[model samples]
Target: MRFSLRSCLASLLLAAGCSAHALAPRSPGDLCGFTEGRTVLLGNLVFMMAGKTTIQDGHNEAYVKQLYWVDLNTTFNVEGAIPPNVLHSTDIPSSAPYESGGAFFAAGNTVFIYAGLMGNSRYDWMWSYNAKDGTWSRAQVDGGKLNVDHRFAGLSAVAPESNLSFFTGGWDKPITGTVVFNATDAADTKWTNVTRVEGDDAVGSPRIANGGMDYLRLGKQGVLVAFGGYDISKNGTNQTETDHDLRPMDKINVFDIDSSTWYEIEATGEIPEARSAFCTAVSAAPDDSSFQVHMYGGRSRFRENATSYDDLYILTVPSFRWIRAPTTGLIPWTEDGVGRDSHKCVSWKDGEMVVFGGTPRKDDKVQKGCSRNYPPIRVLDTSKLQWQKQFERTTKYTVPRIVSDIVGGDETGKATLKEPEGGWANSKLQSIFSQTVARRPDITEVPIPPEPTDPPKSTIPGEEPNSSNTGAIAGGVVGGVLGVAIIAGIIFFLRRRNKKKNDNSFAAATPAAPPAPPSMYPDQQQIPMDSKDDAYMQLPGELHGQTAVPPRYELDSPIQSRNRTVFELDSSARER
Candidate 1:
């Protein structure tokens, strides 16, 4: 029999509906680059540097470029200039090439930009910026000492709350006292100068660039964690005690922020090799251990050649000792990692430390100021203690760069395409399509329920019959059947809607690599430390402590065991 036009149209509609429900959902990677199991959050890293100066002549004075900011995901997020023209001075004097910008601090919502110099010269001007606003303006400490030198000299701040910015080693000229300032109270700027040791002789002459003023906390209690510094001449000489100055204080110094007491840690394990100008950062806490202040890359005269180390040492603040980190597999040059120096490092809460862009091999190549080998950022997990390659790029960077100031927010992303990345952007079309699809829910065909049967009395017309039992029973059965079919149809439609919703969501997530465990030195516990008497169980007080054993990856590992992969930095080194 020939089909009618209405019948043909209905058949075509039914065929089309079947095709729509047959498709499967897209993979999560297609939606987002980060892996489904991982989360990306905002972290802060800052570094310290002297700014460039516009000199009148070749021999003119160098100006200090104070602060610069970076976004971890974007790399170099908020960077430009800090106020001071000189290394030590708060006042931007007319004679000054730039503002005597001293030091900087980042606490909770605000970043404190303090002004000062190396001497007693203090500038009252201060500035602060709300990380949310991304804007900056002048700020001040309520009753703060505006001393520029004390403000800018060797300084460090505590963790968790970047609020308490402290200044440790600086000049007292006639040998007044070593000052520690409190900038925690937004309204108070009182200068509390306490002598770590009495007199100039006992103070051992102020140490500056030797080891920048650093702080490590114990059980969250605030204390100044002191390490290596220029213990001798401004010319990088050994001054104080020939032994103490020469050995670079294998001794770790601890100063109480509240009390004016000084304690030196002496351990039985391996101590960190003495060096200065090295970088340091808090390590991601894998267990209940307090923060590990990881130090990397610095200059040293111990080696016959002008040496900058590619080693890592950790300060276990609670026990108050420095322990040589195990370097067997990860430190010197693992197949999966880069051997580097003068690079900046910062602790990322998600379980890794991100270190970026440092000059390798400070030999004649670096001494001649050769611009080469700025590798992509490398991340090391605190638990695993192994470096995982992440990001790389070739861009010109300013000097005296610090990692602590760089900020990564939740909105940030690390996308690796063969194109220049965006600071706060994505392909517009992708975003539009994603949002449109996400808002639309899929529609499914629902079956219609059968209509109930009418009572036979209807045929009797005005007879008013069928008020009887048999007729009522038949009507009830028909009603129940129709009701069951309607409910079943509704349920099927709801399930279909849910499946479509999940499909759309799958397209919106990011795809990232698999997560790794915290790093451990490959060689096991071979490193030295004062186990029994040490303040910290692992770290040693003096030069004697167990060294960290390096980590050795197995043949089944991803990069090393499988293939001979070659990683080339701006420097010249190749794997066979």
Candidate 2:
């Protein structure tokens, strides 16, 4: 067998092909109906805000302002008893729908839903949902009128220790500033417009909306990092112009809460393309020493031909480094034509990230078509960079009654509901909302095995015997053939010499030849006077008219002997 470079490369490619399939994304099934809603992670539950309820509705689809949740600690069979773990509330207030441009964040035991479009009008009302009481309350803002230009504003909790929540940069009329809301004291909240300082040259603050923003504390200083959103600042008209078009901003904006200074940082290393309406979350790095901002799918642009990404990326804090996350599993939409944008994602326990409902980017011809089918809820393990499809429900449940219908009164008013036919304790809805925390065993990091090393090279000469043995075998065969040819040539030469000697003896015993006839020209036969005596000797009659030349002989040369042996071998081979 012969080894070749091409053969080696081909083998490597074949191995790589097998590896790629092993790393391919996968899905268990659809979790629920597609939604373009907000999501928050609390304990083991992922609470989804308002979203669409169908899979294939065109432009006429309606949004569901209801609250739904899935418990991560328990894996329920989709066909089994409607898992009490996965359920929704039919009693949500109608004024707050978790609509597009709305912001939701969790602080301590309570979740806050801030400024977003309720119906056609944008509202700055801040609503809070108490997890302990399972009730919602509206907060009153004292700083003038609550800024209503907060659609798609970037919102983040000021710090884990503080009750302050910060809202920055939004549109319909994009606000170029930051607003702070104190959950402890609603009257203490205020908004600060980002102002340009004289003689200070830096990248200007971004006027963006629908971008992902989060707060991180670096060395006791709180920093707000915002990335990828729609920017309408370049439009020549005012923010109210209906003809203004939105474009994705590629630069990342960071604000220092302590210094009140802003700096724009250019990201490097597999930076994601400009996108908006994407979901983002903060997770611990693989080393668990620092944190990284993990961002998932979003719309690439705001055009009719805009495409949604199913990729993932993470930006390391402090260093401001961008790393494209290595992901393996059934990627959403590759097999189902369902991509995600304007969705919500949250960091789960054990370095896991959960992605919930979002606007399903479909292939329909309608502009921004929303799929009626619910996209599967995907959980990604950051340590392993692997995605698992946990829940997917095929059968769409009946749309639950709204608060108004349940109360049999006006939609604007709060409704108190009597327990259904069964007592409150026996109702499945009660079990769903009961304040039970689903907890799982802590997931410890698995140690990775070290790669193997090649065996040491042989030190002794010819210790690798395969090649040496092949060479020896070839040399021995050639020497044997040469020895045989030499032996055969000696035998033939001796036999021929003996026959010649016998013929010579016989010729000497035979009769002598007759004298030559008299020359026709006797004068021409006389020897020349200038010739030597030996040259004038008589010649045989057969050689009288011919000139004789001496024969050349090659003698006693090893090269000649070797050449003779090879020639004889070749001749013998031909005859055989």
Candidate 2 global lDDT? 0.45
Candidate 1 global CA lDDT score: 0.35
lDDT of each: 0.35, 0.45
lDDT of 2 by residue, 326-358 (tens): 577645554444456656676654356666655
Q: What's each prediction's clash count? A: 88, 20
* Candidate 2 lowest-lDDT run of ten: 566-575
lDDT value, residue 341 of candidate 1: 42
What digit string (tens of lDDT, one per residue) describes model 1 on residues 378-425? 456544455544321112111110111111111121111111122212
